[model samples]
Target: MKVVVQRSKQASVTVEGRVTGEISFGLVVLVGITHEDTIQDVQFLAEKVAHLRIFEDEEGKMNRSLVDVGGEVLSISQFTLYGDCRKGRRPNFMQAAKPDEAKMLYEAFNEALRAKGIKVETGVFGAMMDVKLTNHGPVTLIIESKEN
Candidate 1:
């Protein structure tokens, strides 16, 4: 499991010109799943994302977690994160899990985030989605469950 977390003032996901999910003053999470991912990976990453202290404190230091700021989450399924470009011009997507397995873990990951008492919104899995966000501070981080 891998995730790209970006702090945002606002964000939305649109599928086929229809907005499916949106959030204000929150984190936009792009999730990628591989064959090895499981419910445990979902659980671990969800907790870490909730507690990550990327928000700023009164002194302008980054010290507050998303929970501290009562932020929302706009989660999107993004298998392109796993694209392998080392070999040639064309990025290989073989590392991305098959849709069926990936969707299950993806849903579980979202549910895990919701379980953490934060409002979690998501893009439709396997759909072509257009994500828009005002990345606050441009604060972004890439996280991998394997590395943790």
Candidate 2:
């Protein structure tokens, strides 16, 4: 499991010219699932994301977690995150999980976030989505289960 977390002032996902999911004052997550990912990976990533202290506090210090700020989450399934580009111009997605398994893990990850009392929105899995966001502080971080 891998996730690219971005702090966003606002974010939205559109599919076929229709808005599917949107949120404000929260984190935008681009999630990727590999063949080895399981519910345990989902649980760990969700917990880490919720408690990550990237949000700034009153003193302008990045000391507040998303839970403390009462922020929302916009989770997007992005199999492309696993694209391996070391060989050629075209990226290879062999590391990305098959759609069936990826979809299950993606849904479970979002559900895990919602269970933490956070308002979680999500993009349609396997859909071609257009995501828009105003990145707060342009703060971004990558989290991977193997690194934990």
TM-score of each: 0.97, 0.98
For candidate 2, the 10 contiguous residues with the lowest summed lDDT are 139-148
**Highest-scoring model, lDDT:** 2
lDDT of predicted model 2:
0.96
Q: Give the TM-score of candidate 2.
A: 0.98
Q: Tally clashing residue pairs in candidate 2.
A: 0
lDDT of 2 at 112: 94
Tens-digit lDDT string for candidate 1 (1-148): 9999999999999999999999998899999999889899999999999999999999999999999999999999999999999998999999999999999999999898888899999999999999999999989999999973
- Among all windows of 10 consecutive residues in model 1, the one with the lowest summed lDDT is 139-148
Q: Which stretches of candidate 2 lie over 4 Å from their true place?
A: none
